[model samples]
Target: MIEAYQKLWPNRASVKNIRTQQELEQQILIELNDELTHPRVRKSKEEKLALAFSRIEQSDLTKQQKKDLVSLYKKIAAQ
Candidate 1:
């Protein structure tokens, strides 16, 4: 991967232009979609929710509080 990127950016000694923010974001979304939908990544809704909940919990929130916040955010996002 690194070699491929370096090949694509031979002139970029810093490689700063190897991936723009928009490109990186699009790639991230693509990876997230794949991870979210892949059975190997998440076998069930519970597994998906657990992965999300874990991320929320890591963000300075208690387990129950994270769940509540995630629910609230989902509601707001849906609207």
Candidate 2:
């Protein structure tokens, strides 16, 4: 019973504390905001994506078309 409990409740040394999706997103948002505000840093990944999306939105493309274009643009930018 004690061994089973030990196995179920893993030690901190054995278990990694991974951030949840929400936590990761918040962290990324903080980093992006910092980069956006930094004068020297200029456009970060978030900024570039946002600018691209904005440009696509301004174009004459339909809603779905713009979304598809933006998705492709993000994928390429991620590379």
Candidate 3:
């Protein structure tokens, strides 16, 4: 669990008392939000693309949801 949290936010400080995957995930989100707010840390375009691709692949979304996601991804990629 700690390892998962560390993997999720490698550069952030180590988190303790995060036992389950869900808690680790929530802590990682908090860390990500903090990083996003900081001007010093900017996510690259490729990183954004990777995140988008992960979102498309990670969930059990419906068929139309997947199609809509792909269409949205295409629009973003076209920009």
The model with the greatest lDDT is: 3
lDDT of 1 by residue, 1-79 (tens): 2333233335644444435644533333333344536567544434444554456666554556555645743443343
Model 2: per-residue Cα lDDT over 1-79, one tens digit each: 2222123224633222324544433433443344436678676777766865666677666676666655655555555
User: In candidate 2, which residue pairs get closer than 3 Å at backbone N, Cα or C atoms, i.e. clash?
Assistant: none
Estimate, for each residue in 1-79, the C-alpha lDDT of model 3 and write its tens digit: 3453344334655455667756655554543344545567767555665675676566566556656655654554455
**Regarding lDDT, does 1 or 3 come out ahead?**
3
Clashes found in each candidate (C-alpha, N, C closer than 3 A): 0, 0, 0
Instruction: Name model 1 segments beyond 4 Å from true.
Output: 1-36, 39-42, 60-69, 72-79
Per-candidate local distance difference test: 0.45, 0.49, 0.53
- For each candidate, give its TM-score against the true structure: 0.30, 0.40, 0.44
Which sequence of candidate numbers ranks them by lDDT, best first? 3, 2, 1
Using TM-score as the yardstick, the better of models 1 and 3 is 3
Model 3: how far is 49 from its true place, Å?
1.5
**CA displacement after TM-score superposition, residue 13 of candidate 2 (Å):** 57
Sort by TM-score, best first. Answer: 3, 2, 1
